[model samples]
Target: MASHNGVNRLFGGTGGVVDGHVHLWDTAAMRISWFRDDLGLPPRVGPGDLARAVATSPVPVRAAVAVQAADTEGESRWLLRQSAAHVPLPGPVVLQYDARPTEPDAWAGMAQAVIDDGATAPGVAGVRLAVPGGAADLSDVAGLDALCEGLAATGRVLETLVRPEQLAAVAALAARHPTLDVVVCHLGLGTGEPDASWRDALAAVAARRRAHAKLSGLFTTSRDDAGRVAAAARAAVDLLGPERLLFGSDWPMSARVAPYAEIVGRTAAALPPLDDGAAAAVWSGTAERLYGAATRTSPAPRG
Candidate 1:
């Protein structure tokens, strides 16, 4: 479809815009992870296309976080490599990998491999897991819980992909590891029954304050229903406040839905306006707090 994203109207605020949710994929490297030909999404859109959108987008987009899809280890690993190789990208724009739970007996041992590789991966800020999706690694409970437990042990935030109703599973897991930070993706997602289960889940996260929510991907999940997404985004901001709200672009996944500019624009509008500090927090500081990404080293005070 032609990119008729509603960016300009929603464009507000002069400070930098940080998109909190997007995904990336390269079809040539491997099959598009989330979309099988059978599931029938638009032709696979990749990073090149997203870069184009970011460059030409009407909104004042300064930075964005690109996440990983459930499938395609190549895409996930490639994103990590790109994060390390690119000199100017200035991120903690990360690759959140999918992880499987281990067999009951072997889980304790296997956790180290996944956690070690992810933590040591060149640009892996953290591992990303979405329930009911991703590889065989995450497709089952025994497997997913195992991975969650391990990531929790390592203190990597649990990047959870959840629909509102299904979020209880993550909540249960979060309950187990009070210390683990859970960054919930897509506002608990949405489908035929999008509702307060998201509110409830956010409450669950808030209670522990061991969680964060990426205020992104509304365009993909809601798919042009800008009003509803805007409303949901506001509620999330109201509940989580600017401090706990992080941005993501949900990129390659957003292709068939809308551009990053529109996603960011709509999400920005939905939330209450921020003062300078809160604005800084949502734009980047908050992510810095959550991800441990290094800030710029100032030039030495030289002669």
Candidate 2:
């Protein structure tokens, strides 16, 4: 229930506008828990306080998939509990648990728990992983094959965050496990020749047709690095096409990188020009179909 000059607008209708890969982290747990104690991955993310970050805007995030930041199932559980509490204005919830090949057996069991809770609850949708060579080298071991087999057996979608350099290997993984619906996060790193390698990666993923790419984390590619990543985004939409494009804020991660709205809004605005309906697909429409949130229709009110 939203209003514009006293009438509902932003949160109305059948349009399932969503940032496909937005992350939700709260101060409920020590931020260090998000990273590894031994690996020292984050300086100190500290218990992330995210609600205020999402407060101002009417971004009714119908469904979001948080990636496994290379840890155990503990973080995933906390996120689920957080999702269960919010109501009405907050919107229904769901999450994607992170999986790593290092602990295949443990990751498998964690996947089951996530599905058992998420799939049945209506908000939880799939499991997330870092594709070989994208984050960690895929050529390192037979881990990907094992992860795929497990996901195929369970009928879960696999979300992957890959660097442009890792596209070929990712393609092979997708081909190897055709049964799994793969979500490629980050528009395959940024676009442009300076990083054309990543763009080629996006092209490779799009060629598979089974692959889906998320327009998330531009802040990682730009702000902290270069400048606006719209050029990179436009390059991806050009190669991958808006049909396969999905929007995401990358949330808490963006807290230090970019405001949630800034990342999502700028990416949406910078998307390669799409004919009316096509733009909606990248911004929210297609996410509804693949993530399965479309079935639960909600009203969309204009801001």
Candidate 3:
């Protein structure tokens, strides 16, 4: 974690930050079904927009992980291209592909394809899937087993956007595939009060050595309640510890509630008091370890 003028450099930033969950999309060029005009996000958002948003933060965002906004191979390719073009704005982009093949053989093929494709795309770090339902639903998800095996084989991460109840299932999934690195996005999307169920589910996730949670998207659920956000952050730290937690802005979408800097400030303020080592782990170290060396070198430019 080297520093320049007190600010840490990209990737290994002890004092600086690593935003593990930022989104980039261009509605005109990409088919993001959720990016409606009424959503309040700009029609097109790129690395430059994110760069400007975090430019004034108290702790500069040295690197970021761009998660998928659309569920298309084309979107994944587009993100790879964007990551290449943007240099280090987003060090790596998470990809999303079809993971719904019901047949075991078909599922295996799809999983193999993801690994094969990812082999060529140096800018890609992992894959994100929306697991909308709870543990039962996860059990019924087609091809998930194959996908987990493939990701583990390649050392790529499996990041899930799951609800509070689904967190226990995610923990089970991680426990099932011990070698696979699992990241639970948005602190299991819990809000209001950190109820017993939510805390238990998070504890289940923490029980898995390779699983982690992101302290992000609090504004989405907590809305303007900064106290709620702080409570959620504290609960995550209490349950998972800073070394197993990561910070993410969930930006552009978060812009609906507040500017990027404001969201960053609020979230930062909400975090529990920590020693520098623990703070660095939550801010950047955990993310770097989970995402691996996706940004160790500049990606090859795509034509």
Candidate 4:
């Protein structure tokens, strides 16, 4: 058994560490249509595969919350099963539930599915809804609200990955679901062209206390600009505070850009000075709060 205590021991006893975002896919399962054999990415990444990967992490990953890589319910179910089995993830596994922005009924159905299958599941954390590239649409506000209301009822975090220009729309959705914790992935897509609006939009969303930020994938977006990544980390800490910030690997996708360990090392190096408790919050505690993983404890990993 890979105990939670095992990971704590790995990081020199920094206590429990949680990976806020992890993506696991099985190409053979036909879940990842974007995957091409020509791309030369791994054909599959299951729970055991993750154990190997995280075993190499600079810090022991006591628990990892996985998000869906394929846009399918099968993928979500597969992750939940993995979590139920305690397969390398002490999870609040975030499942991918796709609902068209214009379709509120569709959102309602998807949200209900989460409540039905995942709401009370110990391994399930909630859902991640992907916002396609281009402008975001809230024209279906009622539908979006239905999806959020369902999520709030289940106590799951609503995670979204949106471009900079689409952030205001995200903030608008957050406003509609004031009680829901909406986590903005990749620092509001801050990795691209230098845009002042990214910072402004981030500030706007940060003003919403229920909004949270994940410090991952920024290096890939910033083209590995260490200085820029560092500045953004500091700025996010300034605006959102350490309690609202969480760490994620954005793995496999990030693997194409840099080693997983480097991503972890760099993110830790980039953060602003924080007290021990505050640093723990960014590394693991905040994620626990967002998804209700605090009381779930497991044994340590083996040597």
Candidate 5:
């Protein structure tokens, strides 16, 4: 059982922490290509599990933004339903939909349709697309310009799951659409060992005022190097500042490597020291502002 006392002490006892990124899925309900039976994770992971994990963790997660795990509209709808069911594990649970189109020409229409559909559901804060190619490849993607325009016009975020090599493209994309809120997941897929190229590319992304990064998924690259992870985090803070960075646990997927508590604790430890204001921004404030989560409040903890 987790208590909010730690959060209270950390943030002057007024607000709770927000997990900027998390994933929940049911292997039986949908097809998650990367999730396997041998991965040591249960077939199903839901908000209840997140609640329990948060309870045990040193940081009390008041709200969460559920990112898309499976590339399907059904999974997005399922996440919204789950979020609606679990009002406040201390706060609100919102979600991002996968709006990637199978055909490049269909992107604009697909994005428009998602925005139209999401208007009725407040939980749909943004959309995510996996960018596997380089900067030139992204620019060549048909209807990408319109997709970014539409998302920017609608004030919906555009979260990209990009590879380390493609980070410069993401930065350019953000520059092209200044109004669109762009978030880079998993610290640009950086590892403990510093790469000058990765740092330079990340710095470019940070230069964009509307661009942000998630301090999550360090284990994926530097599983055994906590010091390396901390160093990377410090560099990110120096590059993006606390206001532009958000804390994400990347749970369930990260559960494949470490427990929820360790994930959150390690991320916390890796960060550069900050005053209360900066710490709150990284932990929750920035997420609340970026995702419009401030209005969503919880009466009490439930697990």
Candidate 6:
């Protein structure tokens, strides 16, 4: 939000934008080994940096769910601490942790312990299970059902970072734990996937009452192809409807592809015909519902 020239025009003074996906990282504070200095990103990006990033946006970033950048409890704890003390109205955090296939019991124990501790962390809104740089196969993940159940019991969400091929597994997980809220991230970031597979899998997940999709990372996935981005947005809207879709700016990562304003503007322009109520749900309401209503300010933005 650092004074991007067309940002104001893009969001048109609409406030109450609840970004559903946000990542904060620092090499020293937490292990961001995946990040490279050559990538042009700063060594660290914390709450203050995030605030400055969105300060000049056309829409007011009323709240955001800070996602885990590293797969460690240290990262989760750091985010929770930041949430408690950040200058901006800190929102819930979607934790990122490593659940390797080889150490099922160890991962389960660690995850269970974290979930136990999360019950007391007010900002503990959700958990993320990401399969780094590859398609996710939850078939071998340990205590997956129990973890999902634990999150459900505590009113926390399970956010999955999976490719389109893996959505069937997500749908199955949702079916098994009907009470759990599962949010699929990055618009099913799969490359060279069949249209039928992506559409069918999304529809399958959408069939679940508690399963939702994030309209994020599209600019990165689509490589800023206006036609492809719009088509993907239209497909999601058509399949899941507005109530189940949430908006997000992947932020500094997406800066490689397009500005924050363009990502939001392009996504909005891509959606199918929607009433004001539906649009509001996509912008912030759904995220509020998923993360937790108490953490977000529900003021409706002006048209």
What CA root-mean-square deviation does each model show from the true structure? 7.3, 8.1, 5.4, 7.1, 6.3, 6.6
Error of 2 at 78 (Å): 1.8
Which scores better on TM-score, 2 or 4? 4
RMSD of 6: 6.6
Model 5 lDDT per residue over 21-64, tens place = 88888989988877877777888888888898887677567888
lDDT of each: 0.56, 0.54, 0.74, 0.71, 0.70, 0.71
Candidate 5, which segments miss by more than 4 Å at Cα? 1-14, 89-114, 118-120, 133-140, 190-192, 220-224, 293-303
Candidate 3 error regions (>4 Å): 1-13, 100-115, 118-120, 133-136, 190-192, 220-224, 294-303
* TM-score of every candidate relative to the true structure: 0.73, 0.71, 0.86, 0.84, 0.84, 0.84
- Give the best candidate by lDDT: 3
Alpha-carbon shift of residue 224 in model 5 (angstroms): 4.3
lDDT of 1 by residue, 1-303 (tens): 223333332232435555656555555666654567665454544445556777655555555555655444555556655545543343444444433333343332222332235343424445666564423223354445555555555445567776675566666667777776778787676432246766776676666566677766666444447667666767767777877877666665564565555555555556565675666666656676766653212211111
Could you tell me the lDDT of residue 185 within candidate 2? 74
Provide the clashing-pair count of each candidate structure: 15, 21, 0, 9, 1, 1
**Whole-model lDDT, candidate 1?**
0.56
| C-alpha lDDT (0 to 100) for residue 100 of candidate 3 | 49
Of the candidates numbered 1 and 6, which has the greater TM-score value? 6
Worst 10 residues of 4 by lDDT: 294-303
lDDT of 2 by residue, 13-109 (tens): 3244565654554333535243443542234231233445545334444444444444345565655555555432123333334444455454443
- C-alpha lDDT of candidate 6 relative to the true structure: 0.71
Q: Write the per-residue lDDT of candidate 4 for residues 1-303, one digit (tens) a residue.
A: 123333333233356468888877777765575778876578888778777777777677888878877666666666666676774484767766556555434553443344354343445566676664645664533455666776666566788887877778888889888988899888877576435777888888898889999998787634458778878888789889989999998877777777766777777767766777778888888887897642222211111
